[model samples]
Target: MTGKLTAQPGKREELADILLQAAEGMKDNADCELYLVNVSEDDPDAIWVMELWRSAEAHTNSLKDPAAIALIQQARPLIAAIEPVKLRPVGGKGF
Candidate 1:
C-alpha cells in the first residue's frame, strides 16, 4: 500500500516526525515487511508513505493496534488530505 498525505501549511515537519515514530512501532509486527516515509522535495507539505504487508488482513488488523491507532489520531489533525493506493507485488528484489 502507498499513500500521499498533504499536511496543513506549517505542520509538515511535525507530521513527518509522527510518521517516522509510527514506522518505528510497526517493527513489532512481523507481517509488516516494510514501512517507509518520504518527504517531497518540491513540496515540503507533501509526504508519501509506502507499506508492504504479508496480507491485506495484516494491514487491516494493524489499524486496530493501540500504537497505530494513537499515531493515526495524532496525524489526523495535521493532515489536510490523504490519498491511498493499493498495490500487488508481482516480484521485486527487496519484496
Candidate 2:
C-alpha cells in the first residue's frame, strides 16, 4: 500500500502520535511490513506511507483487524484527506 495523508493545520503532532500508535500495534502482525514516511518537509501536515505485506489477502485482512480499525477511527478527525495507491514491484537494484 502506498498512500498520502494530509493532516488538519496545526494537528501534525496529534496525527503523528496516532500513526505511531498504529505502527506499534502492527508490530505483532507477521505479514505486515509497514513504512511510515514523512515526506513533506515544507508542509509538516502531509505524510506518506508505504506498506508491504505477505500478500494482498493479508493486507485486506489487516484492514478489518480491531487495532487497525481503531487507528483509522482515531485519525479520521485529524486527517484532511487520504489517497491510497497500489502497485506491484517488477525489479529494482537491492530491492
Candidate 3:
C-alpha cells in the first residue's frame, strides 16, 4: 500500500520523523516486508509511505500493534489528510 499524507503546514518534518520511528519499530515484525517514507519535492507538507506486507491480514493487524497505534495517535493531530493507494504486486526487485 502506498499512502499519501499531508501534514499541517509546519509539521511535515516532525511527522516524517514520527513515521520513521514507526517504521523502525516494524523491523521486528516478520510480516513487514518493506517500509519506506518519502517527502514530496514540490510540497513540503506532503509525505508518502510505501509498505509491503506478507499478506493483507498482516497489514491490517499492524494497525493494532502497540507501537503502530501509538505512532498513529501521535501523527493524527499533525496530519491534514490521508490518501491511500492500494496496489497488487506482480514482481519486484526487492521482493
Give the TM-score comparing model 2 with the true structure, all chains together: 0.85
Better of 2 and 3 by TM-score: 3
Candidate 2 global lDDT: 0.82
Residues 1-95 of candidate 2: C-alpha lDDT, one tens digit per residue:
88888999888888888888877877889888665656578877888878878799998898898888988898999999899999886657634
CA lDDT, candidate 2, residue 37:
56
Clash totals for all models, in order?
0, 0, 0
Model 2 alpha-carbon drift over 4 Å, by segment? 92-95
lDDT over C-alpha atoms for residue 29 of model 1: 90
Clashing pairs in 3: none
lDDT of 3 by residue, 1-95 (tens): 99999999999999999999988998999999889999999998999999999999999999998888989999999999999999988996976
Which 10 consecutive residues of model 1 have the lowest summed lDDT? 86-95
After superposition, candidate 1 runs with Cα above 4 Å error:
none
Q: In angstroms, how far off is 30's CA in candidate 2? A: 1.2
Q: What is the lDDT of residue 83 in candidate 2?
A: 92
lDDT of each: 0.94, 0.82, 0.94
